[model samples]
Target: MLALLRPALWLGSCLRGYHMHAASTQQRGDTSLVLVDEARRFIQDCLLRVGVSPSKVRCISEFLVVADYRGNYGSGLNRLDYYLSDLQSGHAKVGAEPSIISETVSTAHVNGNSALGVFVGNFCMDLAVKKAEDSGIGFVVAQQSHDIGMASWFTFRAAGKGLAGIVMSNSAPTMMGPNSKSASIGSNCFAFCVKGEEYHFVLDMATSVKDIGAVEWAWANDEYIPHGWAANEGGLSTCFPSLALRTPLLFPAGGHKGYCLSAVIDILCGVLSGAQYATHITMDQNQPSNLGQVFIALDPEFFLPNFMERFDDFCGRIQNSQPADDSEPIRLPGELERMHMNYVEDLRAFAYPNSLLTKYKEVAERLCVKPIELAFDRCQSRKSF
Candidate 1:
């Protein structure tokens, strides 16, 4: 009996060791819970090492990390690899400062000089907000920059300063119209923020059916995309290798209506700003490309003395409207994003797939930053929901 018991105990110990090793591997495979503050410091340190001003580095790092923490993976830390690629290939000039090329009392045009778009965009928005504060309106057109991340961030910043804001940017040619067979347009996006007495009304959306990053993420995760979500050679929905060959051209969310908005934005941001538009633009594959961004800020008080009160009342009425479903209530624009932000904050981690985590680790390794580690807890006591 003693010998048999010893053998069973030994077997159990081996099994436990195997489980421990497996758990460690799983932890290493997960990279969603990257320490925000640590990542920010790492990026700032890198920028400083590359001779960027400390204050500017802080601003750019905050924008990037905030997007990461809020689960906007496309605009988040994942973008660092692209920035690094541009820097290494000399497509993007690291540490190059942006300059105002032309200016008026209420408007300015900036030359980013191939700098990182986030830094350039922030600088432009700051100038626009300052002008609006003094003149009741301001507009800035920024050209020759890379991906600037989420448009909502810049608009929200202006809104926080008691100004209504609108932002639009033209990206690389990655979208196609319902009638077009190939990518003939950029994934233009627009964001708006209106000030109110209670809470601001913020709206941000990509003109495409889905963000390109979403498609890439789905493909990496072995997920099937809905047919209507992508375009094909015949201008119909398809998932063929060729259709999926490039960043699959996304259908506009509201069909032709969103396409119209995309066209308008491309015209205003790309053509009007004298930047490359549509198929003429090139992807950021270590090549010189022209991208344009436009930001507008308005002091609502200039139009109406009771604008804030009226806006707040309108928001309340919308919030208290009848629900479309018994379970879930209707939510205004920006409400869902705000909720997700809160949820991510409480969780302290995002539900990222292992594949994405692998890519992130690769990026961290390439950047010489310590790869993120995952934390997990096992609950022995189960509770009924």
Candidate 2:
């Protein structure tokens, strides 16, 4: 398994690098590091006040914290506002759990009832793992859920159980097909995990040339996007952040190749699940996204002998291979995330933007909870507070 973690470079463009700063507090300068435990408590407190069930809040908070720990900050606390908006707008219901609309020995179809997507994802993946444990494989599809933060997390869960896992989701239409200017399909994402004795391979990514969230982050941070990632209304590629956000016509990862893959994922996640598909799923408040997701788990013991041993051996060979660039070493797909977790553990605190921290304070005030105290530099003012 010469697992090519393949640096986020697709189609000879560094669109993925644009999000390397996902964990950055700002474009430049000193940043504040919020204590992780404090942040978690604050999030839980706020969500509970906003009508989220205790179990649901725990799951949601842990999910977001893990994302930040793994350096996937774009999907971490950065998405808090979006989640809050959905809950406040009556788009998501508290204490909603996925119900099995249909099920078999090795397959299940669930309806999330417009609840938080993390709950749906956890339920479907857990179901898959249970079925796989008993029947060698488990396949689950869920509809009517909100956004499932990162597709990789569910697969990683299965990997922890020594099973192969594949997960995918169809999102609201915020992406375009190859050579088209208008948004049509989603940045539809897929993730896979292969278990090994001591390590595992986890690959999660959007089929688009760049993640749409990258553009959203740029828009929020008042930054510019790189060329070739997005296009203007005229179908011409542009680098201006404002134009990209307004139009947001994303390019396919490898041109037509990515477009085809995106389409297939939508078929698996949206069309197959009988949920909203293509442009039918939109960001309009009046329209329900009815997002769909699929999770599959496979037990290696059912088919292969000495699977873990062989898998580990192959991974070792790839890791020991010489790199063309001496400065950079070859890494498996999940290696960087594991490394980031280790770094985060040592820090004990998570760094975020001052503006975002202030927003959290506002949310806390609105929820009538004690705000988390933030440490800031002298250049900032009391008037800002």
Q: List clashing residue pairs in candidate 2.
A: none
* Model 1 score (lDDT): 0.69
Scored by lDDT, model 2 comes in at 0.77
Estimate, for each residue in 1-385, the C-alpha lDDT of model 2 and write its tens digit.
0011111111001322553333342233323556677778888888888888887889899988888777677788878777887887767767677899999999999998887888889899999999999999999999997899877889878988989999999987767776577889888989999977676788888888777777765555445677878888787888776787676688888888988998999998899998898888868654444898999999998998798898889989999899999988898887777766665565555656556677778888888998876533321432322
- Report clash pairs, candidate 1: none
Least accurate 10 contiguous residues by lDDT in model 1: 376-385
Q: 266-343, model 1: which lDDT tens digit per residue?
A: 888888777778777776566754688898989989888898998999999988898988687767787756665665
Q: Rate the local accuracy (lDDT) of all candidates.
A: 0.69, 0.77
